[model samples]
Target: MEFREAIKIALQSLWANKLRSVLTLLGVVIGVGSVIAVVTLVNGANVYVAEKIYRYGADVFTVSKQPRVISSYDEYRKFQKRKIIRLEDYQFVLEHCHRCQAVGALQSSTGKVVSGTHSTTDTDIRGWTASMPPMYNLNVILGRSFTPTEEEHNSHVAIIGTDIQDNVLGGNDPLGQEIRVDGVPYTVIGVGEKQGKSFGASQDNWVAVPITAYQRSYGTSKTITVYAKAGSTGEPLNAAVEEVRTLMRSERHNRPGEEDDFNLDTNDSFVGLWNQIAGGFEAVAVAIAGVSLVVGGIVIMNIMLVSVTERTREIGVRKALGAKRSDVMLQFLIESATLSLVGGVFGVIGGIGVAQGVTAALGFPSSLAVWSIFAGLFVATAVGLFFGVYPARKAAMLDPIVALRSEL
Candidate 1:
């Protein structure tokens, strides 16, 4: 029989029992959908972090007391023992590192910001040095960043985020406006450009003040995050980092055999850590999806076996009419594969839909790879073929006279 003719008959047979075919497809659909949804979410999150979350420029790196991504309790405990990176540390790098182009220090905490009756809680409060604005990509859309002299004088000036402007200040002209941060008053000098949302949380709900003012208010015991940018992005950046590392080691009193006392994190390091976390999620997703696919394949195989039993007399009649054994086998295989392929198509669509729904609900982006869809379909078809072999063989080997006499 022609291959096309066999496929047509297979599809027609499946269509004749619509309810049964659909019931058999549920497992495959669920399995493929889960995998695709996970892939989409993971990929989207990775992209979002790389492009938006990790805003440190190629030549920029940060110095902190601990690494950004801590994986274990032991590591956390170890990091807790490191000495806090302080303003003097920032000054050390600024004054000593010839390879460095710019250096800045920042300290942060969460606090309440108030403007008359309007107030917001859990708002980010940052105390930054004068040069941090450009290094960290913070732009003042209105008014201007505080001058270096202001930073040196411990001026009580603030740069507010759009969220503070809209929610706390009630959309009033924020420039030159007075707002209270944790009960300490600061004049708003500029409104920092809006940063939108990250994973459903507002990124622009923050205010920045001079580092010296922040130290006076919040005290100097708290650690600070320092940033440094190499003038160039290439090999000079490495030399600059090494220079900072050497100075930091000496200042922290680290011996020649000891590890550095502080952490230096770049955009690439952050992304790499994030990817490690995402890789674990992907592995778990694949394992879970694998189980669903296996169950689905088993269900298809059982259904195919029943189909072979029901079509015994049909097979006998075809054999009696000179139908080859291979023809009978091919038709049954095609029917089984068609069942799974259709389920796979539905699964792919449902996965994308679920991913989109989650992205909309959670504010995480959705990214679909074209290859994933094709891979899902191919896997489904392969599962069908693998499981269909037994039933196809059974049907193909049936004795013509005995099959014709059977009641089923």
Candidate 2:
């Protein structure tokens, strides 16, 4: 028999039991769709996190009391509750690290700011060093950054954010103007340009002041975040982190083989941490999808078994009319494969749609690779072929005369 005739027979058989075919396809549809959605969500989160980190600059690394990416709430709480990185450590890095372009410390607070008739509530205020402007890629729009003298002497000068300038100063020249921060007055010496968004929040809306001034005003502790920008492109960030670790370890008086008190964060480790989180989710998704495929395989096997029992007389008639056993096997196998391929296509479409929807809703981006889609389809077809073999062989091995005499 021609291959076309086998395909036609398979289609006819499937059409005769449309409800069973549709029911069987449901497993594939659900499995593929769920896998797509999970992978898409994970990919979106990865993109969002990677962009946020890149925005911080490739040459920069930060050091704090704990690792950059904490895996659990308990770990976060432990870091917050512990005192590891200190002002003395920041000063040590500032003085000793030569390969660094600049070292700066950051102290953050949220408070109210009042300017003339306008006021902002619950605003962000970052206190750092004069060197921070260059280290973090911060650019001045209309005025200069705080001078080193200002940071050293705890000067009352401040830099106003774009949002503060727009809403409070009415877009006028804000230089040398007084703004009350939590009722403490400070003179604005510069205005930062609009920085747009970072990690979903407006970066331009925050205020900046000298670390000393912030500490004096807010009663902030000596502890602050220390950031260092490496000098060379090929400079090893991990080595830099190690250098910082060594300096910190020596200062903190730790014995050899003892874990250092402070935490170091670099780009490579940060990305690895993100991958660790994403990898967990991917594993779960693969397992669930595998289960779905197994269920679909069982359904296919059951349907094929029923088909073999029903087509006994037809198989006998075909054999009597010169059809070979291999021909009979191929026809049944092709039918099962065709059903799985169709279901797989529908599942792929559904999965992609889900992925797109997740990306849109979560404010993250996702890219679907061609290999993933093709993989889903190929696996589905292969599953059908695998599950169809037993039934196909059973039908092919039947004696022609015995099959013809059997009751339908």
Candidate 3:
């Protein structure tokens, strides 16, 4: 028989027992769907992290007193004993680091903001130098950022985020109005554009003030995070980091061969951390999906074997009519593959719909990649071929005389 004829026969068999075919395909559907869903969700989260969490542009990094990833309680305690990064260190970097394009200092505290009866607690009060705005791409939608003189004089001027404007100021014209932050009054100089949530927390629930003013109000004991922008060259970022490290080590009086007492984190560092987390999730998902696929394949193999048994008379008739063994095997193989491919198509659709629904309901991100769909279909088809071999071979080896003698 021709290949097309075999395919038609296989499809006809499936259509004749539609319920059984559907039941057999369930495992494949579930397996493929799980894989696709996981990939889509992971891809979307990676994109979100890159765009929102790492929004400070690629060329910038921050210097802080402690490492973001502390391996143990002892390590955390050791880092806690390190000297806090200060505004003076930021200035030193600006003056001494030639590979740095810009350097800024930031200190933040949580407190209550009050404007008459309207007040909000747990509000982030960030103090930043002039260079912070440019380095962070902090666009002001209303009014303007603080002037150099204002920063130098420790002026009580502030830039409020959209949350502060809406919740405290009631969306009124906020510029030039005074809002008390922890009992200290600050005239509003600007309102920052709305920045969406990161890691399920709102980014807009904060206010920015000059570092000088913040130090005066909130005290200078708080550790300052220093942001540095590297020069526009491939080698400058590493060079700048190295230069800053050397300068910091020398300034802190760290003897040669002693470990530095600060952490330098770049955009890639955060991305790397996210990748590690995401990779673990992906691995677990894939493993679970693999189990489902194995179970589904077993179902297909058992069903195919039963199918061969039920259609013994038909196989015998074909053999009596001069059908070759290869032809019989090919027909069964085609039937198994077609069954799996159909399931794969449905699985892909279901996975995408599920991903979208999850994203909409939970506000989690999901992005379906084309390759994932194709890969899912391919895996399903491969499972069919791999599991169908034994059943197809057994059917092909049946004796025409005995098969015809046997009754279903």
Candidate 4:
């Protein structure tokens, strides 16, 4: 028999048993769908994470009360026990770190803000020096930032975030308006440019004021957070970090091997931590998806075995009509493969829909890569071939006379 004829027969057989074929494909559908969903989510999360990291700039590093990433709850608890980053340390880095392009100190706390007839329930209030805007690459959309002299004098003038502008300032211009912070009134000297969001945070909606003002008004203490922007080239970042470390050690008057009081962090360190988390999630998802695929493959194998048994007399008829054993095997294999491929096609579409729906509903980024689709399809086809081989072989190896004699 011609290969085309054998394929037609195989397809007709599958179509005739629609319910069985559908059931047999379910495992494949589930497996492929799961794989696609996971890959989409992971890819999306990676893109989001990368964007968030790059926002901080490659040349930027920070020294604060704690490191950027912590692996475990125990480690986080240990970090919480560490001393806060102090104003003196920030001053030391600014004065001594030559490799650093700029250094700034900041502190933040949540407080209520009131203006006229309106009030905000709670808002993030940050205190920083004149160097902060440049280090963080923040641009003022309107008005001017507080000057270095204002920081020195602990001026009460403030910069309002976008959200605050809409809430407190209303339709009126925010610049030169007075807003109350924790009951103290301050003039809004500037409005920050909309910086969008990253890492699930609204970077645009954060208010910045003078560090000295923050300390005195809120009793924020001398503890501060410091970020350093390294030079544009070479290992300046590393050198800058070392310089900050040495300077801090000398300022604190620490001896050799003594634990440093403050922590330093970088974007690379945060990325590494994020990957470790993503990797664990991927492993778990793969394991669960693997189980579904295995179940689907077993179903395919069982269905194929049943097909072989049901077609015993038909097989005999074909063999007697000059169909070779190889032809018999090829036909069965093709039938199984066709069923799996059909399942995979539907599965890919379903998975993509599911991923898209999730992204839309949850406001999460979910990207479907070309490679994921290819991988899903390839696996589905492979499952059909792998699981169908045994049943196909069994059908092919049967004696024509014995097959003809079988009652089914």
- The most accurate candidate by TM-score is 1
Off by over 4 Å in 4: 1-19, 171-173, 193-204, 405-408
Residue range 328-405, candidate 1, lDDT tens digits: 898889888988898899999999999999977887787898888999999999999999999999999999999999
Better of 1 and 2 by TM-score: 1
For candidate 1, the lDDT comes to 0.89
The lDDT ranking, best first, is 1, 3, 4, 2
Q: All candidates' lDDT scores?
A: 0.89, 0.80, 0.88, 0.82
- Which of the predicted structures, 2 or 3, would earn the higher lDDT when compared with the native? 3
**TM-score of predicted structure 3:** 0.90
Q: Evaluate residue 224 in candidate 1 and report its C-alpha lDDT on the 0 to 100 scale.
A: 93
**1-408: candidate 3 lDDT, tens digit per residue:** 576776776678778889988888899999999999999999999999888646777778889999667769999889999998888888888789888888888899899999988999899989989878877788999999977788899899999998889999999999999999999999998999897665456789898999999999878887899888885535888888889898788777889998888899888888899899999999999899988888899999999999999999999999999999998898889888877888899889989988888887776888889999999999999999899999999999999999999897
| Poorest lDDT segment (10 consecutive residues) of candidate 1 | 50-59
Worst window of 10 by summed lDDT in candidate 4: 196-205
Q: List the residue pairs that clash in candidate 3.
A: none
Angstrom error of the Cα, residue 57, model 1: value is 1.6
Error of 2 at 77 (Å): 7.8
Arranged by TM-score with the best first, the candidates are: 1, 3, 4, 2
Candidate 2 versus the native: TM-score?
0.78
Model 4, TM vs. native: 0.87
